[model samples]
Target: MNFEDFIISPRSFKTESWQIGSRISKGIKEGSIVLLFVSDYRGVGGDAEMQDFTGVRKEFYKLSQLDFEVPVIDLGDLVSGKTVEDSHYILQEVLSACHYKNAVPVIIGGSNDFAFSLFSALNFHQKNINYTQISNIISLKQGESINEQTFLSKILGSKNFSIKNYHHLGYQKHLNETDSIKLIKEVQFDIVRLAEMMNSTEKTEPFFRKADLVTVNCDAVESFNDPFSMNPQVNGLNKREICAYMKEIGLSDNLQSVGIFNYNIYSDNQLNHQLLAQMLWYLIEGINIQRSHPKERHYEMFYVLIDDTEYAFRRDVFSNLWFFGKDENIENCIPCSRKDFDEAKKGWLNPRLMKI
Candidate 1:
């Protein structure tokens, strides 16, 4: 399928040298970032209007680049298909193309089911995919088809796809079903509650630290003026907190794909668009900053004996980032928080290390 038939080019660009638009185009630079906008919302399992991303691009293009050297390309809006599955197929093709070229794809999405397309394309890239999601609800119940409610179930249960680790962040106890939460624990998947991430993004940072694909449900965001998501919750992360998390998502050394889903395009709220645009900007900024880290090996290793077991910690002397080693070797080290390092001395098994 010719990609031009499915993607309309983004038109927004600013005259300022520091504007993000200055770096966006159709060209695919190796190791660069590519943006895809999806306007179709049929997978939402309700009467949904096709989203208009013109305001989002306008706001994003106007933001200062902060002298970032990272390259970004906006491939424009995805054309809605005759069926929701048709849309998913076209999206999978596009994502696969980006993956083959070794470019990071940042998807501004139509619904949560878009993740199915992202997950499907990921199979072509590599095995043992580490998928991470930030959302306020867990809707993994089996449905008639792949929609927002059953996308996670489709991904986790798919025989063709191989997901090594599935991490759920920002989940609220009230919004999630008891059975689904219990099922997650029974499977031993890593899940962090909304209350756990309110003031401390650090606890959640480790989740994103090594993630391959990260998806954020916009409903997880709290908006007062107008509902920014289809299932907007009364309590969720604020703009600043959400943006900070987006930066963390971008900083991932293994991050390859991302999606921001459930934005209520039916509403004419500029604030909602502005916030989403800024969140994307922060993500790009973070990718640029993370890439600038020195490649030279400057690790400082510390070993401790706790409860008859020896634990090893390694710190990047340059970036001050900490990692918990499975053994003495740095090659097996897993990204961890400074707090995890502190707790290791107290004989507490840094649970984050087990996921590695």
Candidate 2:
């Protein structure tokens, strides 16, 4: 597939420019980080509203590359196909290309439906995929045609799709339907409420750890001086907290694909532009900061006999991270916080250990 044919280069930023172009050219030598923006919002299932991804892309490219060492490439904005499905196919092709090149694809999209395309593109790489999403609303509405609201359901119900684990973060209770929220727990999939996340960001890190793909709905962020997303929420994660989570998404050991969806690009707000750009920057920074583990370290193992069942725990002394399960590696072990580890010492059944 000729990716250049399907993507349009972004316009220059009004803010002060930096050495981003030079850095990206240099970074593409090894494993590069590629940016692909999708500006079509037709699948949002309303009057077609044209969105501008270039606003965010322009701001992203202008940011100073202070400590950025990773090879980066801007594939530029994706030209929407005649139909939404057409766009999905094109996106899948592009993502697959990036995957083959060992380039991490960071997509800024018009709607969350793009996530479905991302998952489809990623299907060939692995079985039993570990997927994580940060969104404000849990819309499982099964519509006649695929839309932003029904996309999640389509993914979950698809016969070909293989989902190992799905972790949802930053969901507000009021915005979500009672039964839809109930179903999350009834199915045993992880769902963290907005209140829980605001209380502690550390607890949510485990959800992103070793994740294959991560997607964030921009609507999950609270609107500040300007609206942060197309579907703006009056209450949600603040700018700092959302960016912090983005960094964590980049820190994943098995990180492959990312999409920041539901952003309100129709508005002419500099604050929104800056916010999204910085979010991307932090994510890239986190990727750069990731400690590549070529060498295996000895994990200190601890055992707790709960109801005559021996539940094991492991700790990586170097990273100061804890895990629940028998194996030591993050992939093999269930990611757990220090609190989960501490509970095991007192014979408490570690919730994280049980599910895996």
Score every model by TM-score. Answer: 0.94, 0.92
Question: In candidate 2, which residue pairs get closer than 3 Å at backbone N, Cα or C atoms, i.e. clash?
Answer: 27-71, 230-264
Task: Please write out the lDDT profile of model 2 over residues 135-242, one tens digit for every residue.
Answer: 988988897677788899988889999989999998998887998888888888999999888845788888998789999999899998777787888999988998
Q: What is the lDDT of residue 73 in candidate 1?
A: 89
Model 1 pairs in collision:
none
Question: Which segments of candidate 1 are over 4 A away from where they belong?
Answer: 46-50, 326-331, 352-356
- Model 1, poorest ten-residue lDDT window? 43-52
Error of 1 at 168 (Å): 0.3
Relative to the true structure, how large is the alpha-carbon lDDT of every model? 0.84, 0.81
Q: Which numbered prediction scores highest in TM-score against the true structure?
A: 1
